[model samples]
Target: MMKYHPLPAFLSACAVSACLFGGHAQAASWKAFSAEGGQAPAPLVLPDLAGRDVDLSAFKGEVVLVNFWATWCEPCREEMPSLQRLQQKLGGRGLRVLAVNVGEGVPRIKQFLERTPVSLTMLRDADSDVMKAWRVRMLPASFLVDRHGMLRYQIVGEADYDDPAQQAPVLELLK
Candidate 1:
């Protein structure tokens, strides 16, 4: 029982190190975060369509789904109604959705709203600062923030909000 091989010795050391470092890396597997298509929405502060401050901190006690979009992006146009439906379905269950339109004017957004039933709170980054900050490379970037103002999950492209796979995390946040 006195054998000392370098590889096995290293493995024993690693096992002990892992035991000692247990639970230290609470969040280590997020290096390759993929939300629908790309990275999640960046933490940002912007104004709603009404120009009122709509920062993430303001919705601390609720599950917030912040989606970044634009009027011209076809995918953005395609997925909005689903997001609206998601809002309607989960409204009473304590879900807040902020659709942040990047760099589009109020009139354009208002005009786009006329054709869809997107009734959630619509925020506008008129100068695109939030968009850049959030690194939104795609049209419909969505982030699910928990009641504690922490981003829990995100999807970069179009997602069927009604899907159970997507809803599970959201419900968890609400709880």
Candidate 2:
């Protein structure tokens, strides 16, 4: 039988509860930065939970939010619900959230999803190559890509993505 790691699971559940129940201080607001003079990132090619290859280039002409995360990260788990809300709010306007899970198997991700459901697109980067290519050193790094496929903004940490202020830049990119 597989041993259950109760500590990590309990801690992650606590983190999510804190965020849901008045833990605003733990969540950081995203800072908008200019991507001028920087080359557009190479295409993000990774497998979905179904093992189908998903390419970021395929999302050209749409505003895409690429988020690098892992099931082990508490903050990442906390911010997931808000990302789902953001996707629901702007999906009709061509906004897509691609959540890239770093260095984890489908079974682990499946277990995490069972505990915390998110409707956004989920991709797996089991080797973490995509995370390295995007220079994501943190657990919940996020980037906004314009309709033209250019990198426009980035959030280095977790944020309340459903908040209007945090959604401003993404909405603007859609225009």
For lDDT, the strongest prediction is 2
TM-score of 2: 0.83
Model 2 deviation from the true structure expressed as Cα RMSD, one decimal place: 5.1
Give per-residue CA lDDT, model 2, range 58-170, as digits (tens).
Answer: 99899999988877676788889999999999999999999998877899988889889887889998777787788765667789888988888887667888788889989
Q: Please state the error at residue 28 of candidate 1 in Å.
A: 22
Winner by TM-score: 2
Distance (Å) between predicted and true CA of 79, model 1?
A: 1.0
Write down the worst ten-residue block by lDDT for model 2. 1-10
Model 2: per-residue Cα lDDT at residue 52: 97
lDDT of each: 0.68, 0.79
Q: What is the alpha-carbon lDDT of model 1 when measured against the actual structure?
A: 0.68
